[model samples]
Target: MTVGVEEEFVLVDPRSGVTAAEAPRVLELLKDERGVVAEFLRYQVESVTGICRSLSEVRADLTRLRGRVAEAAQDAGCVALATGVAPFARVSPVTDDPRYRRLADRFPRLIGEAGTCGCHVHVGVPSRAVGVRVLARLRPWLATVLAISANSPYVDGLDSGWASARYPLWSRWPTVRPPSAWHGTAGYDAAVDGAIRGGKAIDARSVHFHARLSPLHPTVEVRIADVCLDVDDAVLLAGLVRGLVGTALAEERRGVPLPHVPDVLVERSLRAAARHGLGGPGVDVLTGVPVAHERLAEDLLVHVRPALRATGDLEDVRSGLWALTARGGGSERQRALRAGAGTPADFVARLAATTRGGDLERKAAQ
Candidate 1:
């Protein structure tokens, strides 16, 4: 199976690290560029990678795409953060476009409150039937995916006391949550059609679940991750998402039934992930049993091992896991920075450097 990645970055001033509503300037420079687009908020920009057959290709695409974005930001007197949220982005101006204007007009409060960057991985599936089955089986494992991708611990200049504040901050929206198992393609389509009748969702793109059958592509979209810091972390997430999809497709092929996990328990597990990430306690999705994050992560990797091996990504995934564990996931590192730095500037400056090209330049700057 091939994988594609979409990363959303927040634009910030290079000096003070405040959100900069300068996407117009950046987008203008990238007017002829492929794989780059403006997001809902002007302070946000998204970059996409083409369908790739290997982790090497994903890494190459990310490197090239991020380099271009960093150059554009530099030219525009801004810096692009691969991080999930910034202290000042929630109040940043909405993009000046018909769709964004319509949304702001319709959901005034939400428009004012909403703004977060995320990483989405799309893995190919054979058909809608396969995709639906995959989605059904994918729900239980979704929270752990989010926990591994937890990078949003700060917002409005405060540590939100959660490993992933993005979880709760995003819950304010009416439609966002982990998906429920559906009977089949028809059931999934019917639920989506029913949702749009109320006008909360104006189009197919509004089918916002933690994981969903992509309306515009032949892939299952995993939308549970914060934009990762280390490029390897991003690649690791893409690999895991593909593994999850591939594993589910295998289960569908075997005619194994999706497990019947209770909705309340699923929600509880999700909250646990948001609270502890891989640093403390986590609730098991299928069993509703409490366990350490390490155990949960182990179970996750074990569950998807076959798919990883099938794709020849087992080594890359394993190495990435080791690196993330050793260096710390973004949430843990961000918290440590705040704890140690005498000022946010020191952290933001280093964060800006890391977003450009990871540790080499960041360390050189220091």
Candidate 2:
């Protein structure tokens, strides 16, 4: 199975380090590029990797698209912040799309604080049946993945008291909750139909469960991670989700059962991960007990080790993991940076440099 990634970033001014309404310009430059696309907010842009077969392909695609967008945004006096959310931009201009207009009219609070970007991994499945099975088994580990990718710690120019502030903010969407286990493909379709029929979801696509059988693709889409900062971290997130899906599929073929974890316990774990991230303990997957994030990571690695080995991802997983922990994820890094003399402007500035492929050409002009 192949894995792909979709990431969103906030576009900002190259000089002032503030959200810039330069989506139009960036879109114009990327008109012929299918990989770079506009997002809901004018200050937001998205990069979708082509169906990638390995971590290297994922990294190459992300770097290519991110680098292109950064260059174009810089030429237009703007940059892209690869963090989960903009630190200071409280409000933003919505993209000129009817879908966004209807969303704004109906869910004002939802889109009011828009531009909470995410790192979504889409793992190809043999069919919807297999994808649904993978989704059913993926619920318990969702929080673990979130902790691994918790990038948003600041909002409105201050620490938001959550490792991934974007997680809480984005979860406000009505259908964003993790769904209960399904019996099979029929049950999965019923859940999707129920959400749309009950008005909890706008459409099949809006069945925004953290992980779901993609509405339009032959893939299980994992939408729990906050947009990662480093390209390698992005690959790590992608590989982790893919490994989970692969493990689940293998177990399914072996007639393994999805663990019967309570929904309340799963929700608690998610809250714990959002509150503490990897800096603190994470709730156990099967038992709902609290454990150190390091231990939780070890447990996760054990679960996916077979898949990693089979796919030649064991080394990347090991090394990428070390890098993630060594740097302490984006939330930790952001807090540390804020503790220093650096401000929100500086935070966005550093992220812009990362998005621009490490050549931060445009600084705050004197």
Tens-digit per-residue lDDT, 90-203, candidate 2? 557889988777667767777767688998899999988777778878887898898988888888777889999988888888888886788789998888899878877667
Q: State each model's CA lDDT, in order.
A: 0.83, 0.82
Backbone clash total for model 1 is 0
Best by lDDT: 1
Per-model RMSD to reference? 1.5, 2.4
Q: What clash count goes with each model?
A: 0, 0
TM per candidate comes to 0.96, 0.94
Q: Residue-wise lDDT of candidate 1 within 37-137, one digit each (tens)?
A: 98989988999998999999999999999989988998998888877788543555989989888777767788755678889999999998889889888
Which residue pairs show collisions in model 1?
Answer: none
Q: What lDDT does model 2 reach? A: 0.82
